[model samples]
Target: MDVRRIGVVGLGAMGAGIAQVAIEAGFDVVGREVSDELGTAATERIGHFLTRKVEKGRLAQDARDAALGRLRTTTDVSELVDCDLVVEAIVEELQAKRALFVELERFCRRDTVLATNTSALSVTEIAAATASPERVVGMHFFNPAPLMPLVEVVRGELSSDDAVATALDVVDRLGKVAVPCHDTPGFVVNRVLIPLLNDCVRVLDEARVSPEALDAAMTNGAGWPMGPCTLLDLVGIDVHVHASEALYEKLRETRMAPPPRLVAMRNAGLLGRKSGRGFHGY
Candidate 1:
């Protein structure tokens, strides 16, 4: 199906980024927020990012204005009824995501593609919440979705081939690469990346090297664009913890387990960049 109108069900970083990307791709975007405050904040956040791009000479002002014109925000999920595709980018909890899917099924047509932006949760479980499980799939966009080029097109057990093809088409329309993967904990990137970050945390917890030194080694010696510690902070420590716990629960692997220091940091409310402090202070 041709996806011209897109619905996004959260105003958090991921949702906002996905909305902006859709708007920039010339698709009308309707975003649902929990409150008026978040609605306003999401709009302003997207506007600010566009403004930055304009300032950096990466985006034209006219194009930014045009994209902004295609964007709309609301607090009602019913407003998304006209959307050809609805992507849920809310919290990581399975119950919350399932509940949202149930609510979405009420308003959305059975043919309208329903997708979740879940990083590590079960797409099969989320799809089970709706009657037309074949129409449900996982469209996992990375952090800062507009900037990230990779979109994981995850297929649930019952997801239809048409649903997956529609999702891949939408990703291509947004000028992003689509990687197909089965529904699994952490999908692809997180499944491999988080364990490396966990090892870095363990090294820090053991007091073997300073965070700066460890990061420097990875950046200078390994030639990584950003060290694992910095990437962890950028991705948010709490997010990493949750993804790790979810992986460990399903896989029962030591590498997927959240390290002791990660648990301590999350308990202390040091949730990385969003919280202003984590492995290193923002």
Candidate 2:
């Protein structure tokens, strides 16, 4: 389970953090994006994130330099041919991810582990599209990947025990807690957390309480770090919508369905912090 070169196929927030964590864990990372500009920006953002860590005395300057030195950026997915592991953190689109895995199979070696950072989607479906289904697994890192300690090592229907072991080894190398799970919708954390957040939104919609008051009750009364609405805004309304849909479809439970206000908010483009508005202002 010696991981050397790692490839991250997506430059979004989760991808950037995963790349940072990998680089810091002594793995040479190649970050691939759809465009050159995005690749460069993702690289710069990683540098900035590491710089902040150094400023906070959490990471040494020499270590930061070494980590940065290990990072490579490219717009060509084929450049990841030599990578030992490639993790896809792209948008939660089944067709898009399936297409990418098929393409990756053509370029990468037979033994290369193909993992998806999908929070909610069928790992079995994703693996079905790849030539090496046994080697395809889910390495779901939580939001703010560098900061979160939990990593869900999901075993799809066709994912081999070796693949799960390899993913767990990588999780240990990254200094995160690895929780092995089947290809269950929402896995473990989001399966419970998303519904709670949705319930919070329902509470607001039902006139049970105001968003501010509800948030305060959770934080102050329940001793939560942040209110549900605040966390929802940070998680992005669109992300919640996708996760809710996945859960509802799998469990066939109304409680897991996305609240009306959330769907309306997303339809109106009020996608929380990313869109400068949600339950709260950006």
Candidate 3:
């Protein structure tokens, strides 16, 4: 199935980014928010992103205007019925995600592919929320969907081959690489990356190293372009904590356990770049 018109549910950072990239790729995008205020904010966020591209000569004036013209926003779920595919980028709660997909299934056509951007949840569990489980799949894009190139096309137990193929085609159309994987805890990338990120946080707590020094050590000593401290800060300490805690609960492994420092930081609301203060001040 060729996907042209797309529906994005939830207009937070990831959702806004996804909508921007899709429209930049020449697809008609309809975005949904919880309220009109949020809908307007997400629209402005996308516009700002496009404006930055134009300012840097990365996007042309006409192209930026065209992308904005193809974008629409709404608060009603029923309005997404005509979309070829609907992707949910809502809060990372399983129950909430399940409920949204149920509503999406109610409004959207039977052939509309329902994709979730869940980072550390069960695709099978989410698919089971709908009568037509075969239409449900996971299209896990990274934090910055516009800049991130990898798209994990996850197939749940009941996800049909057609749904997976449609997702793969959509990813290619967005100029992203599609990596197919089965419905597994944390999927592929997060399963590995979470453990490493956890270790990074743990090291800081166990040692007396400053965040700057830790970052420099990794970048200069370990050959990593970005250090753990800086990377975690950019990724958001709370986001890393959530993913690590979820994986730890599911697998009950030491490697998946979140560091005590991260838990405390999350509680203190040191959420990195967005929060303006994480490992270092923004």
Residue lDDT tens for model 2, 60-159: 9999999999999998888999999999999899999999999999998888999999998999999999778999999999889999999999999999
- Name the lDDT value of residue 260 in candidate 2: 90
Span of 10 residues, lowest total lDDT, candidate 3: 199-208
Q: Using TM-score as the measure, which candidate wins?
A: 3
Q: Mind giving the per-residue lDDT tens digits that candidate 3 earns over 1-282? A: 889899999999999999998999999999999899999999998999899999999999999999999999999999998899999999999999999998999999999999999999999999999999999999999979999899999999999999999999999999999999999889999999999988877777678788888888889998988888778889998888888888998999999998888889899999889799998898
Candidate 2 error regions (>4 Å): none
Per-residue error for 102 in candidate 1, Å, reads 0.8
Q: Note each model's CA RMSD in angstroms.
A: 1.2, 1.2, 0.9
Residue pairs in candidate 2 whose N, alpha carbon or C atoms collide under 3 angstroms: none
For model 2 the local lDDT of residue 15 reads 97
Error of 3 at 59 (Å): 0.9
Whole-model lDDT per candidate: 0.93, 0.93, 0.93
In the predicted model 1, the residue pairs found to clash are none
> Candidate 1 lDDT, tens digit per residue, 1-282?
989999999989999999999999999999999998999999999999999999999999999999999999999999999999999999999999999999999998778999999999999999998899999999999988989999999999999999999999999999999999999888999899988889888887576887888889889999989988888889988889999999999999999999988888899998888899887887
